[model samples]
Target: MQIKLIAVGKTDDSSLKELISTYSKRLSHYCNFSFEIIPDLKKTKNMDESTQKGKEGELILKHVNTSDILMLLDEKGKSFTSEEFSEEIQKKLNTGMKQLIFVIGGPYGFSPEVYQRANQKIALSKMTFSHQMVRLFFTEQLYRAFTILKNEPYHHR
Candidate 1:
């Protein structure tokens, strides 16, 4: 299955971008992986939090397909160990999924519509993380998961 990570906004830090790129390249060895960045919403100064979330949700939904399994990286979502995450990835590959899309929403989080559209939700950690930092962390975890799946030494029990 092709795995896609869709995050709102771009990472401005060169270090973080480089790290994310490294993991992304590593991931290509194990599976088809794509990282898509949605441009940050324009003219947010006049909009309320809910309005901004709604607009962002609309953009997020545009990238998804009806057949794709959408997962949101949400604060309230379920957290998994590295092994468990690898098993989940294996399950998707075994099931012959076309695309597994995981999304990181905007600063205000996802709207109700986005939440409803998601097939599942996953949380990286209980503590809050910046949107940009989360991209790097998530990419690393994805690489780790793939390594675990392949019985590689990159991940340890």
Candidate 2:
């Protein structure tokens, strides 16, 4: 299955961008992987939180397809161990999924419409993280999960 990671906005920090690129390259060795960045909204200073979220949500939805298995990276979503996440990925592959899209929303999180469209939600941790930082973290975790699936030494029990 093809795995696509969609995140809102760009990563301005050079270090974070480098790390994300590193992990993304590492992840490519195991499966078909791609990272997409949606441009940040303009003139958000005058908009309310919900309105900003709504606009970001619209951009997020535009990248997704009806046939894609959409998963949102939400704080209140289900958390899984490294091995368990690998198993979950294996299950999706076994089920013959065509595309798996995991989205990281904007600072205020996803809107109600985005939530309704998601097939599942996954939480990386209980603590909050910057949207840009989450991209790096998620990419590394994805690389680790694939290593675990391959029984490689990259992941330890």
Candidate 3:
């Protein structure tokens, strides 16, 4: 199955962009991996949090297919070790899923509609992280998971 990470806003930091790109290239060897940056909402400073979420939600929904397995990277979701994450990835591929879409929402988090549509939720950590930083971290973890799956030297047991 193909894997895609959909996040809001572009990475402005050159360092972070380079790191994310490095891992993304590594990931391509194992699975079809790609990223989609949903542009940050204009006039967000004047809009309420709910309204911002709703606008972002619409963009998120547009890219998702009905058959895609929607997984949200949420603060309240379940956390897993790298090995377990690899197993979860394996399960999805084994299930013959067409696409496994994982999303990292905007600053205000996901809308009610997005939450309702999610098939699963995953937490990277209990601590909070900036939306941009999370993209880098998540990309690294994804690369590590694939390495673990392949018994590569990049990941340690």
- Give RMSD to native, each candidate: 1.0, 1.1, 1.0
Q: List the residue pairs that clash in candidate 3.
A: none
- Which 10-residue window of candidate 1 scores lowest in summed lDDT? 88-97
Q: Candidate 2, after superposition: displacement of residue 99 in Å?
A: 0.6
List candidate 1 stretches off by more than 4 Å: none
Candidate 3 local lDDT, 54-131, one digit each (tens): 999999999899999999999999999999998988888898988999999999899999999999999999999999
Model 3, position 104: C-alpha lDDT score: 97
Q: Which pairs, if any, clash in model 2?
A: none
TM-score of 1: 0.97
- Per-residue CA lDDT of model 1 for 22-93, tens digit only, reads 999999998899999999999999999999999999999999999999999999999999899889888878
lDDT of 1 at 76: 98
lDDT scores for all predictions? 0.93, 0.93, 0.93
Q: Is candidate 1 or candidate 3 better by lDDT?
A: 1
> What's model 2's overall lDDT?
0.93
lDDT of 2 by residue, 1-157 (tens): 8999999999999999999999989988999999999999999999999999999999999998899999999999999998898898888778787999999999899999999999999999999999988999999999998999999998874
Off by over 4 Å in 2: none
